[model samples]
Target: MRAAVLTGFGAPLSVRSVPEPRADGGEVVVEVLATCVLPYTGEVFGGRRDYPLEPPVVPGPGGVGRVVRVGPDATRLRVGDLVWCDPTVRSRDDALTPDIMLQGLSSRGEGGARLARHLPDGAFAEFMRVPTENVHPLPPEALDDPARWSCLVVYAIPYGGLLAAGLEAGETVLVSGSTGNLGSAAVAMALAMGAGRVIAPGRDRAALDLLADRFGRRVRPVELTGDEETDRDAMSAAARGPIDVVIDLLPPAAPSSVTRTAAMTVREFGRVVLMGGVGMLGGADLALPYPWLMRNSVTVRGRWSCPRTANVGLIRLIASGTLDLSPDRIRTFPLDAVNDAIAYAAAHGGPFDRTVLTPRAG
Candidate 1:
């Protein structure tokens, strides 16, 4: 099997032959069809992000593939089944608070790192070994173009945050940092889930215009001025109706003030779900006014990733034609060009532009 191996941080990923993964207990081996090359993949690979990824690992988060083998515990899954490989691998021992690890990417902590040791490789190769529960069967139609379906990995994150925020149909929702990849996906997912109006706020004016053009009147794009108070007012005014829910998907480079600005726009008793990288790299902690929360009865929650079942719901949306994955939105690279794929993804990480690696040859 051919794979791109990360021998060390700051070192180039070497494309070479490696042993194909075998199905172990409670695991499934899938032939990699299409896997995403995230914008920050270069950062993690170059030691800039300092993610807890051990050396000599195949690094891809999640992807769309076909099952080739399954463990004895699997009853429903079978060979040749098209499936979405979920990267969120949780420790099965603890149901209440499972230690999480993004298989083939990074671990949460020591506990997650331990879990990664068991399944260290990701979907960057011809075949990947995934936990049985992490594999979700897709509709037969997905076979037409697996590369487009790979966007599911991006949409799943925002879908999870929206679910955490308790988003309801026909309610107004605001997606902060909506010009970026995941944030833009949140805007699309919100509309698909029946949000009456989506307020998209971002610093990129051209990107904001693109969102408005793509979604029409249902989407309101506001160019953020970097002024917290002003941005907050802009979002509130764009909503037309009271903002019922606010989902913050700002990246690490964004200031805490930006998240606070969008969150404060939600109406009283509204919910806010935080699923961004804002304080992860190191900066001032996000501070929401205590008085405002107490008086307004606001509900705020932090979400790491979507629930395990999010993939099922997301696939339903795709199957139902609510969420469209137009092929024009993605750029596909062959498995041998994994390094080139990483570069392309980083350069084109804007909203609606996706870069994916097709591991299997045509």
Candidate 2:
């Protein structure tokens, strides 16, 4: 099996022939069909974000594949099962404070624990050994394009946050940075979850227009010109009323000023959920004017990825064709071209327009 191997921290990932993984107790060996390169993958490669994986390990978070073998005691799943593994695996030391796992960022054990009992390298290789716990059986509808499931984490992030915020059917929602993968998923998932309306506020008019074209009038596009007051007013105008909930998807890699503009778009007593990697890449702290927050009675909360139940719901919805993920154009690459895939995903593709790596291609 060949894999995109992490040579060292901040070093380029090298493609190398590695031994194929085998199923151990409570584990499953999956032949990787498709995987994705997200912005976080780039951040981790650049050493900007922290995860449990270290050098000499595979660097993928999720993938689509068929189980070739199942270990003893792993009765929950079976051989030949088509599955999509969750990005997060249970830590070897779950007894440790969960924060040490960086809120599910650490899938493998610390430092050089690759393809061992305690850890499973990510799905960047031809085959991956995964704990059955992290694996979810896929419906036939998703098997043809398991790559779509790789983007589930992005969709689940905002979905989890919205669920936490008690998003209602008739409430207006504002999705900041709506052109990016997480933001794009936020728009679609919000609508699928029954938001009364969704306002996409971003600096990219073309992307916003494309988003609106996909979802129709229910999605309103708001163009941001880097002017605080102007953008805030534009958000309000786009929504046609108070923004009941704001899902801030602007990463810390984006301009810090954009955060303030998003927070301001919410109406009095509205909820603001921050789910993206807001400060992971080093940026200005999110500025919250306490006086205004108190006066408006705005509530702010933080979130990481979504949990199991939400992902199950999302997968079932996708299976039902209720969400119609087929409309999105997914870009793909061979396993050896992982670097190029990462670059493209980081610079251009969003969840609606994503990039995937086909491990079997090479």
Candidate 3:
């Protein structure tokens, strides 16, 4: 089998021949059909070395594929079943005694140890080994249109954030970075969840127009020119009253300023959710003033997708057709072109709703 190997930090991933993985107790071997490139992959490779990963690692976090074999105790999944995996392989120490629910960002030593157990030789090759607990049987509906499942994989973070913020139907929700993958998913989900109005703040007019066409009157586009007063007025006018929830997906930038604006424009007890900023290559520092938050009784929460429960719900939504995930919104690339795919997604300023990598040509 051949896989993309990250030979060094800041080096291009190379496709090379490698041995195939084998199933072990409570584990299964999967033949890779497709996987998605996450924005954080570049950051992981660029020396954020905080997570448990070393060079020569296979760079992937989430993917969907078919089971080729199953080990003893892996009763939930059978050979030939299509599934989506919780690609973050954790160590017994990390999983058993988690100081933090750090998903895929384990330190180098920790990751190496975890990989030794969870990932067999050539796990990134054509056949990847995974514990049955890490695999979810793809519902029959999803198998018919695999691209739609991309929304489920990427939307977990925002879904968790919105749930944490205690979002309710008929409330106005504001989303920054509205044209990106997660942001677009947020917009669509907010609408599906019965949000009265979804305010999308960003500068991508063409993309916003497309979003508007898909989401109709549910999505309201706002320009982000750093014009504080203008933005405040626009938000206030669109929301009519204080906004119910403000979900910020932009890179670290003026959190204090944005929170203050949100506090004023949102209802007295409304919440603001911060779901972005991880893997930010470069961005300005955002200050969240404690005094202001305490005074206004505003809830400022940081959300990272950790628990797999939310992922299950996201998958159900996709399977039921409640979330719209059209193929035009997704960009597919072959595994050999992973680097090119990453570069294209980054440079294009994605409204790419979802991007997937496949073992074979699409």
Candidate 4:
């Protein structure tokens, strides 16, 4: 099997032959079809992102694949089944508080690091082994265009945040940092899930305009002015009414003030879900006014990755035509061109531009 192996941090990936994976009692082997190349691939590869990924391993989080071998414990899954292999692997030993690791990418704490030791490889290769629970069946139609379905990998993160915020139909939602890839997807997902309006706030005027153009009246783009109070006011006004929910997806480079500004716009009793990297890179902690939160009866919570069930929810949205997956958004590359694909992804890191690697030769 051929895989692009990351020998070490700051080292170039070596694409060469590696031992083929086999399924065990509780795992399944998938023939990698299409996997997304994240925009931050170069950052992770160059040791800039500081992802706790010990190298000499294949480095792709997850992808769309076909089942080639199923373990004995599996009942429903069979060979040749189209599936989306989720990289968010949770330790089965503990259900309530499981140690999680994004296979072939990074881990959380020591517990997650330990989990990674057992499942070190990811979907960057011709064939990869994954836990049975992490493999979800996709519609048969997905076989026709696996790269289209692979877009689900990008959209699912925002779906989880929206779910955590308890977003409801007809409610006005504000997406902080809505110009970026994941944040832009949140805008689309909110619309798909029946949000009456989505307030997209960002400093990128062109990206904001693109969002408005794509979604029309349902989307209100607020070009941020970097002034915390002004940005917050603009986001609130763009909602046309009270902001029912606020989902913060700001990246690490964004200041805590930005998140604070977006979150404060939520209406009384509204929810705020933090699913970004704002504070992860070491900075001032997000300081919200205690009096405002208490008086407004605001509900604030932080969420990591999406719940396991989110994969199914995303599939349903895409299948129902509520969420579009136009082929124009995708650019495919062969497995051998993994490095080039990474560069292309970083350069094309826009709202819906997708860079996919097809490991299997047609």
Candidate 1: C-alpha lDDT: 0.91
Instruction: Please give the ranking of all candidate structures by lDDT, highest first, separated by commas.
Output: 1, 4, 2, 3
Per-residue alpha-carbon lDDT of candidate 4 for residues 140-200, written as tens digits (9 for 90 to 100): 8888899878778788888999999888999999999899988998999999999999999
Candidate 1, residues 138-245: lDDT per residue as tens digits?
999998989989878889999999998888899999998899999999999999999999999988888998899899999999988988888888888888779999
Error of 3 at 156 (Å): 2.0
- Stretches of candidate 2 off by over 4 Å are 48-52, 92-117
Predictions in order: lDDT: 0.91, 0.77, 0.67, 0.90
Listed in order, each prediction's TM-score against the native is 0.98, 0.88, 0.84, 0.98
Which residue pairs show backbone clashes in model 4?
Answer: none
Count backbone overlaps in model 4.
0
Task: At residue 208, give the lDDT of candidate 3.
Answer: 81
Query: Taking the tens digit of each residue's C-alpha lDDT, what string does model 2 give over 192-227?
Result: 888989999877778888888999989998888889
Clashing pairs in 2: 181-351
TM-score, prediction 3: 0.84
